[model samples]
Target: MASEEVVDLEHQNHNFHFENGPAAAIFSKATLPVTLKFKDVIYKIKIEKPGKFVKAAGKSEERTILKGISGVVSPGEILAMLGPSGSGKTTLLTALGGRLGGRLAGSVSYNGRPFSNAMKRNTGFVTQDDVLYPHLTVTETLVYTALLRLPRVLSKAEKTAHAEAVIAQLGLTRCRNSIIGGPLLRGISGGERKRVSIGQEMLINPSLLFLDEPTSGLDSTTAQRIVSTLWELANGARTVVMTIHQPSSRLFYMFHKVLLLSDGNPLYFGKGSAAVDYFSSVGFSPAVAMNPADLLLDLANGVSTGENGEDQAAVKQTLVAAYKTHLSEIVESELTDCSAEPPVAGDDRTLSRWSNTWVNQFSVLFRRGIKERKHESFAGIKVAQVLIVAIVAGLLWWQSSTSHLQDQVGLMFFYSAFWGFYPLFQAIFTFPQERLMLEKERASGMYRLSSYFMALTVGDLPMEMVLPTMFYTITYWMAGLKPTAGHFFWGLLGLLYGVLCAQGLGLAIGAAVMNLKSATVFASVIMLTFQLASGFFVQNVPIFIRWIKYISISQYTFKILVAAQYKVGETYPCGGGGGEVCLVEDFPAIKPVGLRGVSTAIGAMAVMIVGYRLIAYLALTRVGALKK
Candidate 1:
């Protein structure tokens, strides 16, 4: 945290040098000193006004999130934006970072130029919530990020070296082997996790860094450490900008510049030590000794009944008006005096979007997906779910003779029905859970959506299939549906095919709804309707609604299972094998379709598989999964 404690990726010889070609080119040079400048940055969005009556609910209004925000953050200085909730702290930060979308009226430039791919390559943005894979160790997390984010000019070993340097700098070596963890699972501490998040962005040695609330949800000591690290990083001649909420006194002084905001208005933009004096001159200074961050937040929130005893609304109005009248001119004047001039369009900026080839992207994402999903796919609870259901169903229909045709038919249908919905529920949570991580990576151009979705499709399949294989391995011989290996595999294929279709359906519903509760209910209704039309519940479905059978994955899967395990003319002696009644080919419970229709039924499910998954992918695009 002190000057002596700086981690020298360039000076102290960390085995990798910044002078080394494109692989090492990502390291901050401190020579291309970036000066981030924004003038009159304004943002707004439309929201519907809540109405007492349903008919009036469509009435809309424009809500302004930011109003005429202006600031400058030069290299060797760390700028902190201070505000209470709803003061447009994040909106302004996002605009400065070039990630905000909508009707934005402002200009942001790097060294007095618009954002280009070159700036994107050297920029790092850290979201407030740490979006990380929980099962991966800290070392693994950084290593993967380095691989995906670092330019391909670096060898695998070189990327590892970069990661090691960051790990050492962030003091994460102690917890390098620990998993990142989540709410249900426990691994590293929160501060350590926060450090890992910061470490991820620091890997590229970015010239410009934007972090949202780097100190939120942290203890004072931990918060201080994070700010101190950023301070050291900025002293490396990397312009660092972040949003902070109610920082401690010691932590508040670490900032080189403070931009205060209230009600979408910039209250002050100047040195941190000068904030109190500025506010005092503006007639809102605190009367008692207190943390500057607290006083700033209080003033920003117009906390009344304090030393001023002025009306809160009036205080807020006065701050906004005073800032516009005084500081706005100063902001523009400073911008005018800045040494950096606007860059001519397409003159000297280096252009870069993706660092790796698409093939390599797929490979890296596939490998990472495997490592991240192994636990969720085969966790004790999920395995137990499949095993318990298999055991129960097998025991109930355990090795019944062919005479009990109805019970055997029921067992086969159970295989179709269970797998149909089991995988559906499991797959529904996949897209929703990864939404945060996906958006974060995509916004950073870490990988393409196609590559990521392909990896997800391929990576999850092999592991997902294991559940059905385990279930059938236990229940197949136990239930005695078919004895031959050929029959066993055929039935297994049908079940797996049905699983894929159901999973596709789940993915579509999840992407479209995006809410777990709503997706679950919608899927429940749809699958139940399919089950009712599966021919086991009733053969005489109404003609008007009979169309459900054609689109019903369970119905087609049931047809395949029946064809695989039964012969068209086979008869089963009923009444305890006494031949009181025989289950003929025309039995109401089983369709008379033979193996000849297997191809047709499989073709139908194949269509559903592709159709549903295609719909799912498109729905993901609609849900803003792809970079926009």
Candidate 2:
């Protein structure tokens, strides 16, 4: 028991106060004021998935994932943190990256200042998954990103030259023009893609760079090469910090400083070569285990099959003893002394550049939306659907039916309504597929929500107008629905209006729901409600149900279509003189007339469009693309 107490004391060396003058002096110099500083920073985390319900469930039972995680990487030093799986390494990396929120107690200072949102802009984070535009070639992708992101920052020649230089430095020139093939053949190799991601971050030349698992999943040789490449990249006056798993012996020498973590504890953090020796000095004998890496790993985990409590206790004791011995020597040497004064308060408060911030943000978003829509195809399925509609309308036009004018009006409403929803269905599945990329861009400040919204509205014009025009042109002529220029113009306007409204509603629903199934269900319900409320096949249902018609944009759209197709008394009811029969010659004309009903219909559609857009923007800014 006495020996066990000694072992506990040895392990508790890291838990010390600055009561001693020498100790205070050593600690004062330990964390120098720099762009990035973490002073004896301890990050304790409760292990649980992120969300409201799960967070609540594990609120009391949460286990600490990261504990006493403290380190510093100044402006010119690259800190390579090494840790075993489940050591909360990723959590620590993410905390520094500003991706997670928690009851954080540690101080993460930037520029010798406490952390702030502006620091986020100055830091570039590269996750395991490299986010790139798969459709664009390497050069095209980088150039496009540069054009949008660095528009006012550089001139045309300078931008191109900068992108080329970045590409050349990253060894991507050989494959610069090659397509970045992906899951569906959007071309590039995994290594190339990874470098591209790095290049993307470098384009901004952020003051600090943070990467998670930069060498993961590659073969030993490939991993070594990648690590060497990164070492070369970090040669300048730039700070690069990355979390790596079990690195090969060859790659170990590439790191300038190493942070070794085990079971939420910092086992060793300093120069790489002294790692094994430091452990040995603590009472751990390397003779028992030839591999220093394996020994350090086992010592960190604190649990091994061949080792009992005493055996593990000795290892822990050795680590503590070595740390204390090192700390004592550093303090006794009196390398440096701090002034006898309180430290100044850091500038951690974030400052927002309110003026014209939206303008730049919107421009970036608009460009991204335009580029995304440009690469997408609208020829195949849309053309086929339009052809099918034309054929069916032609067949219906030839059939012997009563009230030609009424039939024409019904056909016009059906065609307009169908055309309006095609864009919605197409985007329903597509938006979810690109959700991850959307989040990546959004988080990186690539664009603003309003800008993307406007760009999407404008960029979709080609397909939006073409598809509806084809449907209306075919149906109007084939179904004999008054082929005058006036009729065609109003009919087309009503159809496009419905289509745009549907597009807005679909985007809103898609953005709101995390799961594809839930989004589809919501869209289906909305579509059904609107279609039913539309006064198409049946006019008067019941008062309560009929009231829904006033709110339905589709109903008003159909009203416009009806007025455009048939003049008053041009076609009577099948019963000839019912209450529904037209008695007023000055009927509502889809074409201006007195501009009252037309204005009302247009106004209703405008309100619907804006309302759905507002809902979509709120969903995007608040919910984002994160799953529960």
Candidate 3:
């Protein structure tokens, strides 16, 4: 599907024209030729992998991951990324892929265009993990993606046809219907899934592709086959850029170009065969017949302080010089006396991306959420927990009567308090897992965070309703309160409020804490403290803890209960005998007196929901916090 130009990079005016078939096909109604350029780029990471403090003592010690990295891969060229273990290879790939989370520094341009939304549209990235939906068949996965991304330009049938073509091109026919397996199943070989990952990018037919350790976790032979397939992919006019650790001789031979990254630095970036020769000329020759990849890697890692170190340093100096030379040439060529014409302003519709059809984006998202819940076993657990709560509430009901108003109020408070914390806790439990998936999808522009939040709320509605229904149904009927349906419904509202508030609160907690262990601790302490301060069944809150009543979600929900159910006409504290029209008139406005007494309860819930979501968004955008 054709996308609205997001960015139009004007490097330098070139009157180059392609009349031949391939060129004609690419530039169907072409006007000008633009070149993508990459200038001096560098990335670094702080060494905070734990125990480093003791190792470095009071002295400030730092470690570099990828240093002074720079490269430029134009359209129709494959830049093979190579490095060894701990050589900052993955770091470089991730930075280039725009997933470093924070620890990345570089300007990546396309056709001399900066890496903005428009440029990203023309680029496809294949991470090591085949992150396709596991349940969907290979064709189904790509077809769904195509339908979503290419709907404006392709009909359903056309989408399917496009997916099929990509499938054939990537040699996925043999296992097109098979599942892309994970830790549990072995549906296809590692190589096939890798191909599928690549094929996903092929669907976009992007002008540029970046891959991260694509061949890792696979057999040497399988890795080689995958690289060979990738070579074929690049042959079709895509600029395939991938980071690979140690390739076989044959695999190395297939590379059109290679970029060597070591210790967060670019050691080399040029032709594949020439890389070996380059290292050899600088006195870092391969051991007679050792793999060139291994030799370059050793040369990159062999830096030290003495004579041998000096030799390694000398070799590195040569490689660095070559990197600087290539980087300077590319930049110099792209930006020289560049006076480009004004760009054409065409389609610009960000909100039009919204899916408003019957098979709307929300509908699809809701379905995905439901599927996710079912897969995660949330539905069954919700039912089970509701049933258990119902049984327990029934027992509590069987023990009391409506005459015990104070005790009943206490019971309601306890239930409301429990409900409030339940959602928060569930969020802590479930949101973390979803956070990982969310990051991946968000990076790929799957949908907006609002869409995700909406889907989650909608998808979990049934399950969320179940628990509140169980709680309210059992408690309302057994307490033997007013028999009116209005009363019953209000009772339900009070219960559901607890649940919603909890959901928001839980999400907030998840966002604030980066790791599960820390999140768990934070959730535990906060929930416990809130429950205590909620005045669940306790009459007196410590003077010091009085403020919690204002902040506790349970306090507001319980107050809402009082405001919704209490009969002001019946009684109050008017300084008379038992029933001398004891009244302070109608109940105080739903303020400091009743459900509104929650003071900041609603605000707290809002803060939790919005604050956590913002934090999660920021965290997801971060590139290197994963290590932490």
Candidate 4:
């Protein structure tokens, strides 16, 4: 190790502790460092087979993902799993991290005991994909993470300072203000973004960290740098386990230990630098000088033939048999050596899924939601869309009097329809887009599902009203429906209520289906059905399917908007003279929606708003796999 770099890291660590004492102290080192051990860990799940391929269309088959894999990794060491694609490397990593839920056989333990909440609190799992908000700056990303993951003992200022320290520690000081942009949004490089993800886990300074393919898409230099960072972190009183897919020689040699898997079978579990020698001793050496990682992957794929003139299948069997005959006993001996655990100190509150209280979570998440969604809510295009629609509608029905009942009523219905479809489509993408990020954060036990859901719903509330309020103010008076405040505000409330209800349905559909394409299609179909049955297009339907209108949120919306403008006994000018004719029950837009049910319709829309959001919340709870 270079003295200069080590000195810089030490200085950074000292400065972090000095500047962020409260936040850093909350994540004090564990009493005993974690030692992960797994034995006979087998995982299988059922898959349905087609009738053409099996006896029945729905016949189930058990597919084994992990085949009794066993190994141990102690604290302050790097255990890297290496294999080709579909070799159960990720499966074993996930299982060892205690994040995989299934009919998992055998046992996985931390510090010689079963996986517990205490282990969970101290563990960090970084998935293969970098899940982050593209719009947030590097500083903002880590601050939010620290706020959520760090316990309540830390103040907001301390958390912020701690985030800055992490950024500096990760060498992200120059790019701290840069946004973590996505494919379309130009921002930091892939390597910096990967560090930000690691920084998120590093906020609480976990004792046990697991990363899946941290360097899957980097150049050899960047991959080496990333591995070196992990190596440094592991050496600092932490246990690091990660899955690597075909790493460079420099990157591969940094690992203290390596486990090679082939089709759910463990081919070898030993030192990384020793792997080439072990495979050579087993008669599968490369033809010339080769990267050890490459050779290990070749052996895992059974690409090399044996001295016995074996084919690929025979070669695979030989490797698996050889591991069981030689290295399996060695792994078992290591597991047996440190099987006893010392009791650790912690409480239920500390082990709880959420680090912060509900109020704290709601506050932080609500603020974050506002920060993340403000651009979407107030984007020029979105505002311009509403402004253009309002201006056009005002021009179309400009200064129309009660005499032109059809035009006035049509204008009112336009308000209902636009707000209905607008908010519906806008809110439908909310959950689908955030599904991956949401799952990542929730699985890490950052905050409760209720906190996130509530924050999202409320954070978007003020922005949700902006365009509608603007639209109503322009069209209500410009169209000459009513100059009175009572009528304008009542009609505005109805439209806004409808907007919220439609938004709820959008959220529900998005959460339930979770695929953007499929959710959009489903929402389109459901909304089209709601519009058709909204009593505007078809009022006289058969009795058999008449109940659909009762559930159509758009129908109640249309009714409320219509009732706010139209009165039962209102009179209109019949001619140029002072003669007048009263609007009857059969007036064009008045017939389907009566003026008498405005209050009841408002109540019904309120119920629908609550009901739809409730459904969305429940669907999300299931998706998050909420335990607490």
TM-score, one value per model: 0.93, 0.78, 0.72, 0.92
lDDT of 1 by residue, 556-604 (tens): 8988888778766677776664666654456667853333577888899
Worst 10 residues of 4 by lDDT: 7-16
lDDT (Cα, 0-100) at 150 in candidate 2: 42
1-628 in candidate 4: lDDT tens per residue? Answer: 4544443432232223544454454234433577788999999998876676566856789999999999888878899998889999898988998878889999988766677766676788888899998888999999999889876655688778788878877889999999999898898999999999998988767778999999989888888888998988887768899999988888888899999999999998988889988988888988889899888888888788344445878789999999988899999998899756554334333344456789999999999999989988898889999899889988888999877777887787787778888898899899878878887888888888898999999998998998899998998878987787778888888889999999999999988888889988898888888878887778787889888888888788888887776677766665556685766456755677677877788788889989999999998878745433
Stretches of candidate 4 exceeding 4 Å from the true structure: 1-31, 51-58, 305-310, 339-344, 347-351, 574-580, 624-628
Q: Roughly what TM-score does model 3 have, to 2 decimal places?
A: 0.72
**Candidate 1 Cα lDDT to native:** 0.82
Candidate 2: where is the Cα deviation over 4 Å? 1-35, 40-63, 148-153, 280-364, 377-410, 427-435, 572-598, 624-628
Q: Which digits, one per residue and each the tens of the lDDT, describe model 3 over residues 1-628?
A: 1233221211111111223421123212122222344445566545543454455444444565666556666545677877667777777666666566555555755555445544444456777766755555676676666554443333456556667777776678999988776676567778888888877665545556788878888898888777777676566555677888777778787887787766556777778888777665555565457677767666676642223536765656766776566554653554453445323212224323321233445566677567545544355666677668767766776555434455556666766776776777777666566666555555655466666666776687676666677767876777666678886787677677667777766766676565688887887787677666655545465788688766676666776676556644555443345543433223232223444333355556667546655665455345333221
* Model 3 whole-model lDDT (C-alpha atoms): 0.61
The deviation in Å at residue 77 for candidate 4 is: 0.7
Overlapping backbone residue pairs in candidate 4 total 0
Model 1 stretches astray by more than 4 angstroms: 1-31, 51-58, 304-308, 341-352, 574-584, 592-596
Q: Tell me the RMSD of model 3 versus the true structure.
A: 7.6
Query: Relative to the true structure, how large is the alpha-carbon lDDT of every model?
Result: 0.82, 0.62, 0.61, 0.82
